[model samples]
Target: MKSTQLTSTVHLDYGLDTLFGRITKSAECQVGLEQVEHDPTRFALRVQPPIPQDLEQAKTVLVKVDGRRLNGIIRHTERLEDQSLKLEVEPE
Candidate 1:
């Protein structure tokens, strides 16, 4: 599939050992906010493949939404047949 421009970018840590750990990178596919729940500050994020490697294993993620940087943890990850990923996060 053709790559589309990402609306928002997320920076994920691979681990303390990986090269990407020191310098996080943006996701490869477009990112869209699906939903945001008020209680505990949880939300859903949609991303297309190729998904970032670190993202899959990341326990936490850093993202900018509406000009605000949010630090969140991955609650869940759902894989779609079309090679898209749905991520559920809870802000910390």
Candidate 2:
């Protein structure tokens, strides 16, 4: 499989609820999509680390793929021995 190297940004939303309701905590990281699977309905992005530390607390993750913005949640994340991160995302 061929992978596309592109500049992608990861948006992480921290769901923090306060007396005022949910507090919006967000962080953005400039990363690369190493192994990408694009389908008619969804995209599976294998993010090249090192992923932002803030992502550990992220409830929602949004990625900018191509010229389109795709929103998804982080289904799984693994830390490789090489210190890289592999993320399984399902587009919503």
- Clashing residue pairs found in predicted model 2: none
Compose the digit string of candidate 1's lDDT tens values, residues 1-92.
12224575454332223655543445444576666544446776667667876666666667664555756777788887887777778877
lDDT (0 to 1) per candidate: 0.62, 0.55
For model 2, give the 10-residue run with minimal summed lDDT.
34-43
User: Which one is best on lDDT?
Assistant: 1
What TM-score would each prediction reach against the true structure? 0.62, 0.56
Local error of candidate 1 at 3, Å? 19
Tell me how candidate 1 scores on lDDT: 0.62
